[model samples]
Structures are given as structure tokens and as C-alpha cells.
Target: MAALAHRLEDDDHLSDADFIKISNLIGQQVGIKLPPSKRLMVEGRLRRRLRALDLASFSDYGDYLFRLDGLETEITYLINAVTTNKTDFFREPEHFELMQKKLVAELIAQRRDRLPLLKVWSAASSTGAEAYTAAMVLADMVAQRRDFRFAVLGTDISTDVLDIGRRAIYPAEQVVPMPPGMQSRHLMQARRPGARPEVRIVPELRRLVRFDQLNLMDESYPYDRDVDIILLRNVLIYFEKADQAKVISRLVGHLRPGGYLLLGHSESMIGTSITMRQVAPAVFQKT
Candidate 1:
């Protein structure tokens, strides 16, 4: 760890031109922008990749990344290195509160004729926390009334994080913010013989969520049926305005009429031309 940190601190090979090229490549492929202000951050993250490949500098890494064979194989590592996965269980509490207060209630009211399955897509679900949290709530609701069923799908561009999420074993600190009752009901203590103790999402909650690798920049999502609600929070800030509009439009096309779209509190649809109406701050309902 110390050696890795020292190598990261020594990454002075990220020249301005190399940074721009790398940043542009990431933006083109992932729709996430890394501006000049993020050069140091980009350098720091990619240094580990450089060390792993035994590359001497960012310039050689860029050359290798853009090479014919590198495009096919190295790009995965490149994207994994650059993508940010900062998340917590119930990171934004009000969104889930709104789900419990309004969305779930509406689903129950329409349970007679409407579809019995409530599909939720956590569209940039990093590490599965958001998706699991959604499952915990929906599972509890299902326990109360057996009239409806809910399934949560978590998707992200990072396969590495998706794998971790699929495993569902997290550091104990990850569940500390969860309410004691919820922690008990949805998670189980799993202690390995030689490893630090961890918490795993119980089998019931794990059954309700499925993770997939998805890039929001794609023209259309791979969903067979439109989703009932989408939790796409805290991801748009990484995109440029035009990219944000394009991604929003594509996501809107995947929502069932009257379904809700939740964004980060700091995000807005000010310039986007979409059919959604702002039902709450940073919350849009598809028309």
C-alpha cells in the first residue's frame, strides 16, 4: 500500500496533451468528462494501472490504450480505473421516503388490474447499495401485503464494481449508516477465519436484485418492459450538458407512463427537452 501510494505521488508523466486525449477518449466512450481541473485525479487513478502494466509513463499507456489490440482488451482496465463509484446505502433518504410514501402506495392501489410486478432500475448503481436498499424496502412492503411483487435491477458501466455488488459482501462499516432494524433484517454477519468480519445481504434481499453491466450512453436500454421507477441519482454530474440531455432522453424512453425518475439533488433538467414534469425537487414523472 505504501509503495502504491508512493508511485501514485510520483506520477508526473500525465502531460497536458496526454491528459486531454485520455479525457476525450473516456468522454467519448463513457459519456463522463474529466476536465483540466481533474487532471491530478485522473493521473492518480491511472497510476495504479500504469504500475500494473509496468508502463513507464502516461504517454505509453495512452498509446497502448489506443492501439488496435489494446482497444479490445485494455479499454476495460482503462474504464475501470477512471470510473468513480462513490455510494452509500440510503445516500439520499428522501428518495426512499418518497417511494414508501407515494410510489409503493400507488402500486398497491393499482394492484387489482395493473401488473403485479413493480420493476425498479437503479441505473448507475455502484456497489449495489442503492439497489439493495430499494430491495429491503420493497421486500418489507411485500411482507405486509402479498398482492404485489418487486424486483430491482442494478446496472453500471463498471464490471468490477458490479462483481463486488453481486457478491454482496461489504466491509462492516458500509452497513453502519443503516437503521439497526434494517441492518438486522436485510444483512447477516459473515466472518471468515482469517479475514476481517463482513456483512452480506441476506438471501431474501439478494434474491430481489440482479446486477448488469450497462452504459447509459447507449442508444437504447436492454429492458424488455418499461420500468416502474428509476433511481439515477448522483451520476449526471459527471456528464456534460449535451451528454446529460441525451442520456436523460434515452432513460425517459424506458420509463412507463407515470413512472418516476429520481436524480441527484444537485442535478436539474433546466436545458433538457423531455416529456417529464418536475413533481418534486430533482424528481421527474414521465408523462
Candidate 2:
């Protein structure tokens, strides 16, 4: 019965009004057009938002959002509400493995590269697992190297999860992929009396990360630093083709010379002139 109750939490259904209300709201804000077929997903994301915001129904919230003048706060609430953060520490081993051998050593050897930064913007960084995972990779690589230099920027649209990111804590299951040797060096495990398995990122590795808010569709982006790597993973599948192209163009525009774009294994930029050439199954290099 207890297991059944937990399963029920993942199961959600949206009403017609809610389907339209959320679809239009997200579309207007982030330009993500939610179609009718995705109604249930929108409902699931919004359910958490509704509970957190203490709103009764989609219609009521919609009216409130529509009437609201300052959109930043409300937008922050929506970003945190809509996205799912189900990531682990070593979720993608290949990319990190590559960085360990080539990127890390090179960055470390550049003695004159002061203020040098290597960033892999986990654009959809949810609960910060992905960003922290990347941070772990850099930390491990640079810890023994004498002249190492790096930083990771994790950005997301969700304010709620961003809060979780800043908190830098996670349940045991979510942090499992990390190995024991690296785990101790990278994460600070926490388990108070009668509490469950939880972990927080330690200060050393935490300093290497800077998390912030980002909207993929926004034209006037605030970031000016050139990124060495950009991880716009499975999140792009949610956007329409034209929107995907637009976002890719914007993301690629920020990549540094010879930097890489690491995408989800299933995502692609088949026909876009984002100036990136495919390097592997889901990896691309700026041309």
C-alpha cells in the first residue's frame, strides 16, 4: 500500500482548461509550445507548482499569472515547476573520460592562462546533479595537477530546483553512480539520526560551480563568457523544430573556438547552421 501511494504520485492527469492554460503560459514565457498530446506531462509538472504556490486550480493560477506585472518571480516559479531533475553523478561517463585525458591536462599545463575557465553549461541542470557531476570531473582532474584552472556554470529555468541546486543536497539513490574513491573526495555524505541517505557537495568542489537562471529562448542573454563545452541535453526535445533551431543557434553562438557541444545521445542538430559540426553520436565541435 505504501509503495502504491508513491507510484500514484507520479501518475497525473490534466483537465482541458489546464492543458490550454499551462500550454499558453509556458509558450509565452519560454516559447515552448506544449501541444495537447503533452497535456499529462504539463499537468504533472504543474501539480508540484500548484502545491508549492498554494493555488487551487489552473484557471485561477492562469488569471493570476496573466494579471501579474513582474514576471521574473513567477517565471522562476514556473521553471522550477516544469522541469524534471532525475540525474546521477556519473550519468555520462564517456564525456568525463574524454575530459580527464585531454581537456583537463591541457588546461592544467597552461600556466599563463590566468582567469581561464572551462565551462560546460548544463543548460537543463535539474537539482544540480549534472552540474555537480561535471564539477566532480574537473575536481578529480585538477586536484593533483599543479596549474589547473576551471569553473562550471549550471543554468536552469526552474527556480524551485535552482533552490535545490544551491542547497547542494541529494538522496542516496540519486547520488549512487559515484564510485567510493571519488565519492569521498567529491561529495559530503549526510545522515542525521533517524534520517535517510543524503549528501551535500563539499566547499572545494562547490566553489568551482556557479548556478544561475537561464531561458533558452531569450534573445538578450546575460552571459558573455565563451564556454568550452555546452551540455544542452534531453531538454531540447521538448521544443518544436523551429524553436530548437533558434535555441541551437543561440547556444552555439556562445561556444569558444574549438570548444565542444555535448548533447543527449538521442538529440541532434541535423539541419541547423549553428556552426557546429558533428563529432560523435551526440557531440559537436564548433567550426
Candidate 3:
């Protein structure tokens, strides 16, 4: 058995061909094209996956992933583990400013069930700040009205972050950079007082948002695009152009005619999409 395993180890590292296979699988499966710049990152994250499965080397693990009888569950971990998820309350503040200052005014008047409800979708809402920010905006909208219905939906590929999102608990440090008014209105410092200091969204605002796990690469995947606003921020940098087109097209199909799409400042629709028109820096509208 020891000799058999030694043979499977075959060398200390995966070959270049093996790395390409892994890259193709990620691109084909998750819509994320891993550039050569990510070589070190891939090796670091997948090394754990290899050892966890008792595989001796990455080559063995690659074969195991593609085997006809193998379970595909680990593939998700492969995607989630590699994706960057840096975000916070209004990381790109201008987009949210547009939603509050412009988009809401254009929405038909709020009238109970018939009220022009605001639905904001945070497409790559990792951890939860973006989603919660949307919820806070809508709740403030409601507080000004006699009656209204508003919803914020946040989706991501990370099961781990989805769990945190649903719980709506955040460390106090995560919120320190937010402005005083927002920090006070939407959050409450937790009771723990000392150790790391926790903070959580206030109950009323917490009730307005929901979270789910979604993969942009799933062809049959559907997004609830009937929203007043959609925030697909800071996430498209991982996808190549074709994948971006496919995901953007599908996402736009769900938007209400006058709805807005907000991309990361560094992200853009490129030349492939005709469904939206540029409205401002990092903002687009589908009409």
C-alpha cells in the first residue's frame, strides 16, 4: 500500500499541463478564468484540498476531480476558496448614492402592497455589508412613507459567507469606517463590550434583507432582476469577456425596464452587451 501511494505521488508538484486543466475546469465550471498571476494562489488553496482527500500530489487530485464517478461537491470549494471577497458598507459609495438620490425618486410612489416597492439585488454580496446597506436604504425610505414594502437580496457563491449574511452579525471593526450617522442608524454595538467588540444590524433593518448562495456559471440559474437596483460590484474582474457577457446578459434579463445595474468602478460591460446604457461612472441603466 505504501509503495502504491508512493507511485501516485509522482513528484513534489503538478505539471504545467495539469495546471492548465485545472484552470479550464474553473473557467468552464465557475465562469472565473484564473490568470497565470493566480498560480501561487491556486497551489496554496488546492494543496489543502489535495491533502484533505489523502491525495499525494496535485496531479492525483486533478484526476480525481475529473473521474466519471467522482462527486462534484469539492468543485464548489475550489471556486469559493479562490475568489476574492473584499467589501464593506458602501465600498463604492457613489453607486448607493445614486440609488438613494436618484433611483428611488423615479420609482412610483410607495402605497402599501401597491406601493412602488424597491427591490435591490446585490449580486456578489459576500459576507453581507452590501446587502445590508441596501436594506438600510430601503428601510429609511420606508420610515419616511406611511406604508411601503422593500426588499434587499444578496447572493454569493460562498456558503460560509451566506451563513454570516443570514445571521447578520458583524465584528465592530468592520463598521468603524462608516460615517457616524449610518453607523448609528443601522447598527448597534453589541453587549460584549470588550473582546473584539461585535456589532449587528438593528432589528428593523435586519428584517428587510435575505441572502442566498448562487453561482453565476450555472446556465439555468435565474436572477430576480425585477429590481429597482442591482449591485454586481467588484466581482467581474475574475471573469473573462465571454463569461462576463453571458452572466451580464442573463442578469439584465431579470431587470425591470427602468432598473439600474451598478458595477465595480474597475469593472465594465465591454463591447459585448447591448442591453444596458452607461449612465454615470460605474452605473448603467436598462430601458
Better of 2 and 3 by lDDT: 3
TM-score winner, 1 or 3: 1
Query: Each prediction's Cα lDDT score?
Result: 0.83, 0.71, 0.77
> What order do candidates take by lDDT, descending?
1, 3, 2
**Tens-place lDDT digits, model 3, residues 1-287:** 99876555544566688678778877877777787888887777777777788877776776776664343777667777777788897787887777778777766442235666778888999999999887777677677863557888889988878888888888888887677887889888866577678888888887878888898887755656477778888888888877888877778777788787888888864522555778888788887
Candidate 1 contains a number of clashing pairs equal to 0
In candidate 1, the residue pairs with backbone N, CA or C atoms under 3 Å apart (3 or more residues apart, or in different chains) clash, namely none
Query: How do these models rank on TM-score, best leading?
Result: 1, 3, 2
lDDT of 1 by residue, 184-274 (tens): 8988886552366689999978888999999998888888446888988889999988888888888878887778888888785542355
lDDT of 2: 0.71
137-182 per-residue lDDT for model 2 (tens digits): 8777666763556778888777767788888977876777787887
Q: Assess the local accuracy of residue 219 in candidate 3 as a C-alpha lDDT between 0 and 100.
A: 78
How many backbone clashes are present in model 3? 2
- Tell me which of candidates 1 and 3 scores higher on lDDT: 1
Model 1, residue 66: what's the lDDT? 65
